[model samples]
Target chain A: MNITKVLDAKGLACPMPIVKTKKAINEIESGQILEIHATDKGAKNDLTAWANSGGHELIKHEEENDVFKFWIKKG
Target chain B: MTDKKKTTIVLFSGDYDKAMAAYIIANGAAAYDHEVTIFHTFWGLNALRKDENIPVEKGFMEKMFAKMMPRGADKMGLSNMNFAGFGPKMIKDVMKKHNAIPLPQLIEMAQEQDVKLVACTMTMDLLGLKQEELIDNIEYAGVAAYLADAEDGNVNLFI
Candidate 1:
């Protein structure tokens, strides 16, 4: 069974959220989802580029009241 | 994907001229198609500040000392480094004379090349600086944050 993990990356900046999300994703099997909660505005762009470069799937990315949520489905 | 190598540079040199070597190297790496991330820390963090002054060598002896020194900025480590203490102002002047582009322009070029410039948050707090005090349009992060991005196949180095 695939597992999903929610990584609270809020308050983390730039590369941190991306790095932590990647680590969390690595702990799971392929096809699992790693949900990253980040606050840095740069993540909106940086994460997308990172996911693309790493060959992972970014399933969803949304912002709610200054909080950013990114869902990555591990490859 | 072609599996191009990724690299992360940790800059801790605060001396103006010394820090330039890292900035130059980071941009050079990206220019060659390598993905680059620079985590500015400690004295190195000043290089990212918008209002930070480019230090100058004072007095005749200080100037003579600078002229005789190897570029300390490049000494931050790793190979392919050397500098004469003329410092960042002199370095900038020399580059400008050669039409080598300005630091701000270089920064823009780095961004255009997708180089990641990460300002260290802890250093910022210790210095009592605000995010607005840094160069416009760069990102900020803690050590854990930088390590995360650097964890996957990126050549990590302390510059």
Candidate 2:
């Protein structure tokens, strides 16, 4: 999948990662994909809820070496 | 009619942690494209005060209240484990270490996101707080305005 922007939110705590993701998602065009890398465990659930509420699609997500990565397509 | 979701928060506490929680939720809701409003009342008004003292004429009681209350969000104490005002410093340290955005910046972020910051006019009068004592770019209103926004709100909270 094509990624329009990459957001590095590692090391940030609750709300920061989500805040940054929201801002990052706005910068990209609708229907484009935004990739986010975060270390916060809460980001997984929070990002999923955020994407769902914002009408975005979380197309893919995976955890590797304690890092959580997500690809969300703006809706 | 617009279909945008709305989140209205009534901030009634003066504690640092409580204010931070309110702002965090406000900023987060705003990020989710929800129309957000934080109504500052009573002790919560301290979060909107200016750090520097402004030379505004006031009565004796007003002056006393002003002297006792915190001047700004940064000066407010924590709701728990305050330890005679040392808790805020410890929390600040932890927040810095975790790279979390501080309360002031969170407030600024809310402003940037166009979240409506409203100061309760009735509370201001009761507390002897003048408009000059608070920060700029915030709306002044009573409970009526708050209800108008909250009646159609998707989420309403009192913190």
Candidate 3:
């Protein structure tokens, strides 16, 4: 995926990652991808629900070395 | 969402942890494009207070009431394991370590996100709190107002 920007939400807890991700997503144009690297375990569920509720597209996501990476396309 | 949704939270607890949870939920709902309203009543009104009391003339009983209660989110106590009032501090430190925004910041974020913050006028009068003592930018209304808001809300929570 071609990400327009990357947000480092690592070490942040629930809501903060989502908060930051939401803010970062606004800076990109429609269809542009925003990549978020977060460590909060709850980020996965939160981001999934957030993307769905806001009509954003979760292009891809993966987990490695205890960090969760999410690629969200602005809708 | 295909249609707009609303989340209404009745904040009735003064506990720090409970207030945090309420704000977290409110912020999350707002982030997801949900219209959110937080009705602060009774102890929950403490979350809206200023950190320092604004000097105001009042009767002795009212003064005592104002002085005894927690001033703001930072001064609020934990519901349990207070440990002589140290539990809140410990939890705050832990929250800092985890990089979680505190209740005050969450409240600010809630405001920035346009979450409706309505103070219960009845409770405010009962608690002897003045409008000037709370943080800026909030609505003051009675139960009927909150009910009006909650009536059409898709999510209603009591915390």
Number of the top-ranking candidate, with DockQ as the measure? 3
Give the alpha carbon lDDT tens digit for every residue of B51-158 in model 1: 443354356654453344322232222222224333444556666564444545555656766788898988766655556556766788998878876886356778
lDDT of 2 by residue, A1-75 (tens): 999999999998878888889899888999999999999989999999999988999999999999999999999
Residue ranges of candidate 1 with Cα displaced over 4 Å: A1-75, B1-4, B52-89
Give the TM-score of each candidate. 0.48, 0.97, 0.95
Clashes of 3: 0
Off by over 4 Å in 2: none
Worst ten in a row by lDDT for model 2 chain A: A12-21
Better of 1 and 2 by DockQ: 2
**Which digits, one per residue and each the tens of the lDDT, describe model 3 over residues B70-93?**
999989999889897899989999
| Best by the lDDT measure | 2
State candidate 2's DockQ.
0.78
TM-score of 2: 0.97
**What DockQ do the predictions score, one after another?**
0.02, 0.78, 0.80
DockQ ranking of the models: 3, 2, 1
RMSD of each predicted structure = 14.8, 1.0, 1.8
lDDT of 3 at B7: 94
The residue pairs that clash in candidate 3, if any, are: none
Model 2 C-alpha lDDT per residue in residues B1-46, reported as the tens digit of each score: 6889999999999999999999999998998889999999999999
